[model samples]
Target chain A: MSVLEISELTKSYPVPGGGEPRRVTVVDVPRFVVSAGEQVALEGPSGSGKTTLLHLIAGIVAPTSGRIVVAGHDMTALGEAARDKVRARHIGYVFQTFNLLQGCTALENVAMGMAFGTGVEAGRARELLERVGLADRADFLPRQLSSGQQQRVAVARALANRPALVLADEPTGNLDRRRAREALALMREVCAESGAALLLVSHDHDILSQFGRVETMAAINRAFATADGNSPVETR
Target chain B: MSRVPHHPVALLVRRSLRQHALSSAVTMAAVALAVGLVMSVFSIKDQARNAFTGGTMGFDAVLGARGSPLQLVLNAVFHLETSPGNIPWSLYEEIRRDPRVALAVPFALGDNYHGFRLVGTTEKLFADFEYRKGRRFEVEPGGRMFDPTRREAVVGSYAARRTGLRVGSTFQPFHGLFFDPDTQHEEEFTVVGVLKPTNSPSDRVIWIPIEGVYRMEGHVLRGSGEVYTPSPHEEIPDEHKEVSAVMLKLRSPAAGMALNQTVNRQGTVATLAWPIAQVMADLFERIGWAHRILTLVAYLVVAVAAGTILASITNTINERRREFAILRALGARRRTVFGTIVAEAAALAGLGSLAGYVVYLAIVATAAVIVRAQTGVVLDVLAWHPVLVAAPAGMTLLGALAGVLPAFKAYATDVASNLAPAS
Candidate 1:
């Protein structure tokens, strides 16, 4: 069964000031699908609309025109609140910066991943932390952990709610070469172990070489990879 | 899905309070201080009024030489203020014989022992009069009422405690209201009894027989000198006898009113203070501005404390935008984010309000001592009052109200942008 399916998804943003009245289309994906238990690497340089595509799939930002179904829920048709619920119940995201809550323990951060979903499942959080080789470090806060360890905790959090799909955007961007390889291996191995599909985006060729299946932004999205998606969007 | 916390917002708020312990404590302490002050002002004001009026517990009216009725009540009943001079002893006999009167106790004042008043009354005051409803003047187990014919006295409980004068103690009376070494009388009076604490102005007095006051060597009546001590065979003339004030308890409320009209309007000798509670309540009404000013100041402190809550939360909100964004990314709704901010404020105020009672107790305990010293009314610091419950609850509600501004700021937080690396 497919965990993620996107068809003719496009996101366009209007220019900053209203003078010439031009709109930039950041994401124009004709079709995309990731079956359960599949791990695919998406390769893209900076400002190539890779993050925008991930945002659309995650329902963090709405698509200008198209349908996105994640774990059988229609992401495009849902309101922001409903979309948030869908994302919480179906998708887990791992940002490059290890966005763990600074004030919470590793265990607490994992629990927070399940906060909006199943209330909180402490035993499951502990089990995931133990699986990530951070059982002894569950009480430690984010600042107390090393960069590799933080990413490990983030991976644990991503799989906390038993998500159907995991979207990792440059997950190993800050790690050294060996740590990056190890982090990627652990993330992909966990996704496979948990029967969740993994779609990881990275710019490094070395990182993409490890994946059995890989595709570049130009191949998936037909839009020009020019605008770095930091501005407001307007659907035309 | 946690260790039974039930909600992450509360858990997050608890952690945030610990993280910013200093600012949290400062804001909470401000809230606690305001709650304490507001509660204390209402408590002490109410207690003082009750004690002042309650001092007239068993008496129906006060009759003194023509003077301000308030002054007469204060002077005779409370041992406060100066005596409004003296009325003839015949007037006391006339009131005592009146059919409307049930009990009449005469007091002659004008002397002191170390600033404690010396009231001259018959032994009937200790044996028959009730200082409070159904509670008579109780002397210590080994003590007795002062001997009416001898130079003996009964020390009130507070006067005994303050001056260390117990039974068998002796002291010379001063000729004036204030204790003066030069004005000390040559005559010595024995302390034969010590009355128990009545928690009224009566507790601050030294009681002697009326004969001692009238025949005290230098006491002159109608310029008669009366220099020598009266013999057992020779009695003071009825025409020369005088009394300062008479405390009356009438048979009925109507009788009190009739006597008040007759003595105050028809006759010209004495003023009658009927309905003693009203006299005290009127006094509070006259000085009501002070109570209002205190209440206003307490409310102002609460407003300032609420401002601190606003400033404190707003300051932290700016730094924690990413934190909130992270929660949004974690799938927390905007309402959850809003609830978290409000809960933090309410938690601070609620915790502070709980601690406010401690502050209130400390303040009232300190004020109670001062009040008891100034006016012998023992304030019950631990007594329950409506303000006790209202102040803290109001503070917490106000705290939640204060959080609305910052909660809105948090609710409008841009998750997509704030989630971006702030570099």
Candidate 2:
């Protein structure tokens, strides 16, 4: 069964104009799917609607028209509140900036992931932090931790709920080469251990070869094709 | 995350406040100052009322020369002001013999010992007068009431302490209610006794025999201000005797209205004043306006403090837009984000009010002694009034209301745009 499935998905925004407003589509994907526990990487250059696609899949943003099924829930048919509940119960997200609550300790940040849906389990959050090799840094606030350590904490928080799928957007964007490699390896290990499918978005070419399956946004996002004709759609 | 099930919004609020420590402190201080001002007003008003009502408990009516009822009560009961005029000694005797009068204690004013008023009265005042219900005056240990024949005095404990007069101390009396060194009487009175503290205006008085005041040089009758000098063999005339006011206790509380009407109907020779009613009415009439104005100002301060909370939280929400967006992405509903912001504002208000109450208590505790010394009003900081509870509750509600704008802004935040790489 597919953990995430999208068909005919698109997102658009209206640009204010002196005359009539014009709508610009940002994400246009005909079909996309990730099998249960599958590790897929979506690579795209800047302004290719990569982040918009991730947001649409995670149910954070509603699509203009499409079917989006995450962990068997039809996100497209659900309201914003229900979609949030679905995300909390079955989907986890890791942002490019780590996005840890500034004053929250690492363990607390992880615990907060489960705060809305199932109620926070401190033991589970601590265990996840330990699994991410941050057992000694559980009490350290986001600002106190190094970039690599903060990313590790974010990964731990994403996996805190043991969701069916984890979406990471440029997880190692702020890290050094070695730290980025370490963060990527830690994310992969945790996702595999939790039996959650991984959908990672990044523009970094050096990290592409490490994933088993890689999909480029240009291949799927129809909105990117007409805007940048020199770029060719390709997937490997 | 330590095995405790904590609300995420609560954690977020705490974290947010900690992140902006200086702003939070300033907001809390503003709230504290407003609460303190409000609570102090409430406490002072309550204490003053208690002192006024409690001080007049011994007397039901004041009979004095035609004058303001309020001034009569103030002079006769609280010793707060000078008597307007003198009533004839025969009127005191008439009230004492009246069927409706339970007790009539004559007060002869126009004399001061040091700065304390020298109240000229009989020992019946000590034996019959009740300061509070069933609470009578008691002489301090090893002290006794003064003898009426000799120039002896019984001082209240407060007066003794304030004037540094002991049982063997002798002091010359000043000729008027206010002390004047040039008008000092040559006759000296010995302090033969000291009364225990009564927690009333009585505690600030020096009690001397009424006959002793009549015998003093320069003493005059009700209509005469002539200085009466007794020759070596001449007896003082009884018709020349006078008293400042007569404090009357009624046989029944219901008889007070009848006796008061009777005394006032007997022409302008003497007027009846109900001590409690007159003092309270005077107090509410005079101090009531100031209380209302102060209360309005205090409420305004609280409202402004709430506005401060609103401004502070709204400012924070604007800066924390991205942080909230990240939480929304983490599966928090918009209401959750909204609630977190509201909770932050409420927390600031709740903690600020709590701190404000503590500050109020500290101020009341520190001022209690001085307030009692000056106004004879005991300020009990532990006294529980409904306003104490209402003030904080109102402040917290105002704070939550203040959070409404900021919370709505947080709820309507654009998660996608805020989380975008460009943003």
Candidate 3:
């Protein structure tokens, strides 16, 4: 079953007051889908709104006009509160800067994401932190850790709830190349092992080759096509 | 399959408070100072009111030669200061004989030992006077109220306690050649009674009969041949009469105004004053400037403390904004964001109020000794109520107002944008 399906997605932001209000139309998607257990990357230029589409799918940002189905739930039909509940139930976000809560230790940061889950077990949080090779640094606050270590904590937090949809927005933007590769590999392995549909947004083309599926923003918006079975150009 | 979700909002707020512990302490200190200032001022005011009321419980009016109302109350009620002029004792007797006057006690002041004043009045003075707990002077190591026929005296609580005077202790009123020369009489009076400590001015006075005071004055003049009595023990001629002030108790306190009007019309020698009204009027007049100044000072202190709290919270918001955005992204409702900030402000205010209250109590305790020495007013420093101590609700309100600017900034944060690529 498709874990996520989007049709006719559009997003517009109004320009600041000046001349006639200039509107930036970012997304004009006709159709897209990611089946369960799929690993995909959305590659685009800086202004292509790959992050925006990821946010919409994760229920953090609302789409201007579209129907989005994630994990068999029609996200567009849910109110803001219900959307939050749905996102909490299924989505895990790995922000680029690591965005680990500064005050909390690495273990605490991972456990925090599981606090709202009905079956959120502390053992799972500890196991995931151990999986990220951060078990020794579990009690160390985010500020005390190095950049790569912080990113590992973020990854641990994303997997803490064991969600079905994992969204990564430039997850390796601030990392070195080696750390970036390690993070990308770890995320891929973790998401596949957990059976989560991973939709990663990134400008780094180096991370895209490992993913089985690729969609450029323009192709996803129906502006281009390729010979592959996937409607959007795979680019490789 | 039913999927379990993460609960991030509660976790975030709890961690936020722990992370900002130092800032929270600073905010709490500010709140404490504001609360303490308000609490101290209110307590002092209440104590002062209680002391003044307790000290002047009895006494309907004071009659004397025209003078300051404060002076008149001090002389007639507290027996601490002197009246401006003397009224004839015969006039006091006339007033005492009236059906409308329940009891009239005449106070004749002209002498002092050390700095404590000596007051001469009849035994009726002690009978009419009442102190707390109904414990009067029992004259336990001394004698009783001296007979009006004898040149004997009764020592006040403080005088007897300090000077070690017992019954039959004789003291002479020896005036120096210069220095006011108010009491030049060398008449000796034996102490017949020692007053119990009343914690009022009565504790510091020496009392004798009016006739003994009159006899002493006549005896002083007799040696100089300026004035002579028929004999040393005989009463002085009526022409040499003198009484410093008269304290009159009315059958009805409500008749004070009428009594004052009637006495003011008397052609002899005396002025009438309703002491309670005069003391209130004097208090009102003095309160205008002093109360205003104290209140202004208290307000400024609280305002500054509140300003410090506001600054602390405002500075913290920038560092916390990203965290707030993370909370919003993690499914924290907008009201939750609002509530967290408000809770922080309230906590700071409550903690600060407690700190300030402690500081206030310490100050009052240290200053109480000095205050008693200087003004003879004893302030119970620890007398406080929780509701009275929490006087910074206004300061807390202002702190909340200051917190709103930051909370609004936190709530309006774009979670996706903040969590997006920095480049």
What TM-scores result for chain A when each predicted structure is judged separately against the true chain A? 0.94, 0.95, 0.90
Candidate 1, residues B1-423, lDDT tens digits: the string is 225255788779988998899999999999999999999999999988888876545788888889898998888887778888888778889999999999999998888898888999997787778878889998887888988888999998999999988899988898977778788888799999999888887888899999888767566554122323454447887777778888888899999889978998998878888878888889999999999999999999999999999899999999999899888877888899999999999988998898889899999999998877766678999888899999999999999999999999999998767766411
Tens digits of per-residue lDDT, candidate 2, B44-109, equal 777767667654457878888897888888887777777888877677878899898999998888
Give the candidate order by descending DockQ: 2, 1, 3
Best by DockQ: 2
Q: Give the Å error, residue B20, model 2.
A: 1.8
Write candidate 1's Cα lDDT for A44-76 as tens digits: 766677777887888878889998999999999
The alpha-carbon interface RMSD of model 2 comes to 4.6
Clashing pairs in 3: A115-B7, A116-B6, A116-B7, A117-B5, B31-B352, B31-B353, B32-B352, B32-B353, B32-B356
Q: Which ten contiguous residues of candidate 3 chain B have the minimum total lDDT?
A: B1-10
Q: Categorize the docking of model 1.
A: acceptable
The model with the greater TM-score, 1 or 3, is 1
C-alpha positional error of residue B344 in candidate 3 after TM-score superposition, expressed in Å? 2.5
Which digits, one per residue and each the tens of the lDDT, describe model 3 over residues B177-253? 12244655677888888876666657667788877766664433222224444356566665456567777767786
